[model samples]
Target chain A: MPGFAANKVENILDEGIEKGGAKLDNKQIEDVIKSVLDTETGERLKIYVDTCVHCGLCSDACHHFLSMGRDPKYSPAGKVKRTLGEIFRKKGKVSPEFIKSASIIASTECNVCRRCSMYCPFGIDVAYMMKVVRRICHKLGVTALYIQDTAHSHSVTMNQMWVKEDEWVDTLQWQEEEAQAEFPKLRIPLEKEGAEIMYSVIAPEPKFQAQLIYQAAIIMNTAGIDWTMPATPGWDNSDMAMYTGDFEIMGRLKRSHFDTAARLKVKKIVMGECGHAFRSVYDVGNRWLGWKRPPVPIIHALEFYYDLLKAGKIKIREKYKKSVTLHDPCNVIRGGGLADKSRYVVNALCDNFIEMHPNREHNYCCNAGGGVINCGPPFKNKRMVSNKVKADQLIATGAEVLLSPCHNCYSGLEDIIGHYKINMEIKFISDIIYEVMEKPA
Target chain B: MHDLYNFVRGPLAWTAFFIFIAGSLYRIIKMFVMIKKKESFVFTFWSWKYSLRSIMHWLIPFGTVNMRMHPFMTIVTFIFHICLIIVPFFLFSHNVLWDESWNISCWSIPDPVADIMTIIVVLCIIFFLVRRLKEPEVRFLSTASDYFLLAIVALPFLTGFIAYHQWSSYQFWLILHILTGEIMLMAIPFTRLSHMLFAPFTRGYAGSEFGGVCHSRDW
Candidate 1:
């Protein structure tokens, strides 16, 4: 017991948890936790709680635990023991301090990546438990400020980044014109009824990464694909509400997203290279809406790229001449099963492709994926520190460039590369595809 | 001593077996009914194919990443579970009990093989106890109930091994074995040992979600 200390990461006082906790009483917290457990949960949650034997096999599956010096608290089972286990043991008679740490452990510490589920002897979905904890936190007004703010933006604007309606349309037009200068006929079609595909992107694409939209336009036009982007609220496919555990707002956001595609009469919804958003539309949000599946069939961009390249819709001008390793985003690879597809797109785009040691569905999460990074500056150091395994994984691949197909992964890997001083450039698959694909002259 | 062993093996044994069967059924049915009430879609999405595949993979030793990561634990756990079930059902002695009680019995493992398995099980239980004590992650989550549950799982095998070897006080060990076995049977529904009862369904549901819904392998 002597000389034991956790590596210090400065904690920032988050107003979201602070303000929410300040307003809450123990009676309200107990009621919220009890109600969510009794009513919102089904056998999945109950059986998982009962079934885990405390074997701790899931510890290594977590990047947080592996990265954080093998700390017990960072382990998946450890986190659940602290949050859900304690709550159930006490029958929801927990204090605000308990709720505050529980919120952090559920929302920020764990990525809900489902990697642990794969490793568990029972295939217990710890992520589902974390989501339940997050839901209770949401109900009791104790969510992370940054992600909660994004969820607020989702409720109001149906976008995480809160890009205005005109701004959304303008970004598309601007990217369309930029691509037009090279292709001379490229158009980022907005709200074209009966289009074969509805191309949706997270609002951040328009807000911060508009060039990604421009690159997508070039690829779509080069491939002669019929795609439409809505000039409305549902244009952004990302739902921060899902991460915030505000399921009501998540349902509303998903409804608007699906309703938009149906109104446009698009055949399928093709989402951009964002992991959590893909999870929202393709898995979580649709389920919450009581649809067995997305009413409009959804294709993650990894699949879209694979389909395009396989069909010879897009021709590579020249393969990228750098050694590259692929970082499989947890949501798309593990959650969506696009590992092989993403690899296909990468192999087509690059001259030299390397595989990370535990590639495919077995890959580790980008700590940034499950809204952990979006918990913002308060947890940035903690986020980077919790990504030590990832930084090491990236360094071990010894590739000149790392192709992360998801937006969150791209940024997350970039931070890891910088933080750990790993010498690798990070990029999305689209970045390489657009670079090498032939543009119409 | 003989009468005590007879009582445990007769009435106490039957009572323990009855409780195990009835309580397992009650818990299973209750969970299914509760799931139907709350998340009925579990029924819609539940696939026999994925469930079987998922359960099968997990059943294999070192089949999952975490299993491979902890090969020692995996091998020990696989041995522990296999020996635990096999030594009871296929043991030459226990089958004799079935033969005496119901005039029906299954094929029995040779006495020597069953004895080796019993020793292996006792050793595995020791490994589990040490790991639970030494591993911080496990220790942090372990309650007094957890430790008690481990002892409950360990004792029957330990007592059985000593009785089978005809160690010092074998008559006493024999009765202890019967009592411990009954205690284990009775504890299955009421303790963390229920994992054995519910693992298949939990694994099945997760397998279905990943395979049927996400087109992914859970294991």
Candidate 2:
């Protein structure tokens, strides 16, 4: 636990303090200043730092602020003031005490959801600002353990979960077997060249939630979509390297995923229900690799569902009986722009749809994501408390079930809902559709 | 009097038009090229589809529908924009220039509609100004440029309205309008108001591709 000083998290914090904080010798400060602020880009960074208006409109949008009983200091603006503000004011001449506090604020306090940007009259992206703080912390080598560990896995195995190549194949085959039990003829086809779609997923699907893969396969089989799952290294698309700000590893993970798709020569890639993973392939990773856009197109699960419904490839034998509301995943919804289509899918699948007030791009974030929840048990309480706004929104929707499209949102919403003791079932959109859609003969 | 106004108007009109067109084009083209070279959100189509859902949203229906998804702001925004757009394009003096420039004859809205729109727009501006002051959230996020932007916009309208009413023995209301208009045109490229060009692009690309990645319907 971070509360214990000798823990790994604390060690990383101490290391950051030792390297960049005031405890550093004169030579260390010189090195730190040279490394961070001597570049030409430093001028532009300075302008951005000085431009903030100190308006705290970004507070309620932050799960950390809301969860912490509306503590003003936890707001995005306040976090910036305490960390980035101090650094800028001191010209990055921050002390060891400052670095320790900065580490705690960046690593544990913020989830980097861009919801605040929407509410910003100027559309200032506060999330980007927080990420810059995290980047500084990262350069100091002080990222949270679980997410950093995942990034290491991505660097070593080219997948976030350290999923071995053979094991990745076996898992698909295993899921295919399981799906066949539900729909006996169902197949999780692998490496079928010229397939229309190549299905990819995060490592967690195999590591913790193989049944999601099984459901997706069954849905595809029933829809008769020409999709194949890769048998090798690029099979997993989720990249924790992104959240850890390990741009180099993030780029490598993305390259392999894209290269695999290119090798298989699939027309397009369809990723599983993971928001951050979609953002990785679509935005950050590709940009880091110097591509303006992905070489091959990528489609998220929400788009896939909408396509299936529109094409009549999949038919709902009966509407889901439950009243359900949709939780927009920040990366896919706010970042990717899937707000309405998510609603369309929800409406198509469910009989009763109650709009979560402030739904769509304007919707609140599930604070568990952006690797905040991945900080593990030490920070679980903080994560739960930080997302009170989201919990309230979910409760107000008055729906018996919530259909969230992204994996992070699914897990995060589940944890928050449970923590708050809200009476609702958190489900993936596919989970409901898979149950109700008529399987092919 | 018309001749004197026309002389100043000819060069001023061209300057404003040139700045508006060239500056807006430069910003739009730059953003388009940038987005074209970047990655598409996995849910781009879905967002595009929804953003396009209400044609009315993109084209303000005016008094026909005052309340849209954004509520009070939407209505006020529509009024301000409509007045800001129409007054400059279809004002009586502007129409005279139109006749001289292209030999294209058109009519300004009759006094009633024009006055109503102008009043509505001015009222909205006042409401926004007051709202900014009254609402903590709005006040918190606002910058020096934000208040300056509102002033720049409202100054022309206020001066133009005063000149129309001839509220005082003023020599420079029309001149003030032209100067303010010029300032706004020049500022358009540099300010957050540059969103007039960039907003559509960012929204279109970010929202469109985002929809695709989320597996939602495009638009």
Candidate 3:
């Protein structure tokens, strides 16, 4: 239990406390905790609490524990103890300082990756417990400021980055024009009713990584897939609100995204290489809206690539000759079960595919998902340090390239590679496939 | 003293058995009742199959993903839980007691084997105690109740071992052994020991959710 000294950087929790400290009195904080514990959660909460033996077996499963010099406080069980256990112990009459610490623990410290859940002897969802802490924190308006701002963007513009409607359409048009240079007949269809797929992506794709959309356009056109991009709001599938525990905005965002697909009369939704977005639409948001499953069938980009490769729709001209390793995004592999298919897609496009130790569902997280990276620059040093385990995992592969199929993992890995000087190039599956695939005549 | 022995061996045993069964049933039933219902928007496929598969998957010793992570602990825990359940139910003395009380009899392990198993259980308990104390993560998560439960589980075997060896007051050790066994039985449904009953449910639910929807091959 030695102190884990923070590097020289502004801590988001301290800032959140300074700003949101007086917003909630002791009575209000207690009331919020009581209401959430009593009403929001049911047998799941009670059973998990009663069943945990505190064996600490899940400690190794967490990246924070391993990367931060095996600090016990960073372990999944310790995080739960610091937040939920304290709440139950004090009967929710915790001080403002406790709430501030709890918010930091729930929001920034843990990624809600659920890899620890996979490792729990009793399958206790520590991520779910962390989200419960986040729910309480959200009620008190004590969420990390940057992630809260992203959630606000979801509220106002139906996207995390607040790309206006015209800007979104313009990005698609620009990508379409770029793709047409490769295949003159290629077009990025917009709001085309009855299309086979409604392609959706996070707002960052347009704001920053527009080439991904350009790549998608090329792939879709080359494969002759009937796909459309929504011209209206709801094209962005990412949900910061879900991570922030703002279920109201999360629900609206999900509903609008699904409703957009329905309005377009598309058969299914094909989301980009984003993990949290897939989880939000298929699991958390759908469940919140009383749907046991998503109303529309949504396939992640990994699955989409696998299907295309398997169906002979997108043929590989020559496998990319690089010693590449795959970073399994927790949402898609552990959360969505696309491990085998992801490998299939990777092997099909890459010549020398090396396996990372503890690959697939057992793989370490990219330290980005669950809004940890979205907590923004103030917390970058913390994120990088906590991701040291991942850097070592990637380094051990001795692969020249790291192929991550999720946007958050891509960004997170980029940061890790640069910080650790790991001499690796990171690319998404689409980036590789687009380079190596046989273009339609 | 004769009355106390009979009460501890007879009425107290039956009462503990009743509480154990009833309390366990109540906990499991209440868990199911408390789960909120939701309608599936898409057709759910092979949910029951996945749940059953998950339950069977984790039931085998060292079969879980977590168990594989720590090999030494897995081996020790596998031996410990097997001995924990088997030595109690299949011990020769327990089978004899059952036959005398209700004309019921079952297979029993030999005396020497049962004794060996009890020793292994005691060793495992000590190992676990050391682990809780030494491992910083485990030490942080360990509560008074966690330590108390470990002691509660170890008491019966320890007292039984002493009574069988006739190393101390035989009658007193015997009485303590039976009393501690009854206490463990009553505590099972209320403490973390309830994992004996709920592990299957939690593991199964997790398996079903992952396999059915996520199509994850977590097991």
> How much does candidate 1 score in TM-score?
0.97
* Clash counts for the predictions, in order: 0, 42, 0
* Candidate 3 docking band: medium
TM-score of chain B of each: 0.94, 0.78, 0.92
TM-scores for every predicted model: 0.97, 0.69, 0.96
* DockQ of structure 2: 0.09
Clashing pairs in 3: none
What would the per-residue lDDT of candidate 3 be over residues A271-380, giving only the tens digit for each residue? Answer: 99999999999888987787777899999999999999999999999999989999999998888989899989999999999999888888999898899998888788
List model 2 lDDT by residue over B1-219, tens digit each: 555466446787678878888987876565445434442322233355644432224454432122333466756776677787887777776688689879878878776677677777778878878877876545645567778887877777777777777777454677676667777887776665665654444344333443444333221
Error of 3 at A277 (Å): 0.9
Looking at model 1, the pairs that clash are none
Ranking by lDDT: 3, 1, 2
lDDT of 1 by residue, A71-159 (tens): 98889999999999999889999999889888988988998998898888888889989989999999999998999888888888888
- Per model, the share of native interface contacts recovered reads 0.77, 0.09, 0.66
RMSD of each: 2.0, 7.6, 2.4
Chain A vs. true chain A, TM-score per candidate? Answer: 0.97, 0.92, 0.97
**Each candidate's DockQ:** 0.78, 0.09, 0.58
- What would the per-residue lDDT of candidate 3 be over residues B1-219, giving only the tens digit for each residue? 778899998899999999999999999877766663321221243267777777776767677777777889999988999999999999999999989988999999999999999999999999999999999999999999999999999999999999999997899999999999999999999999998888877777777777887788546
User: For each prediction, how big is the interface RMSD?
Assistant: 1.1, 7.2, 2.4
lDDT of 2 at A5: 26
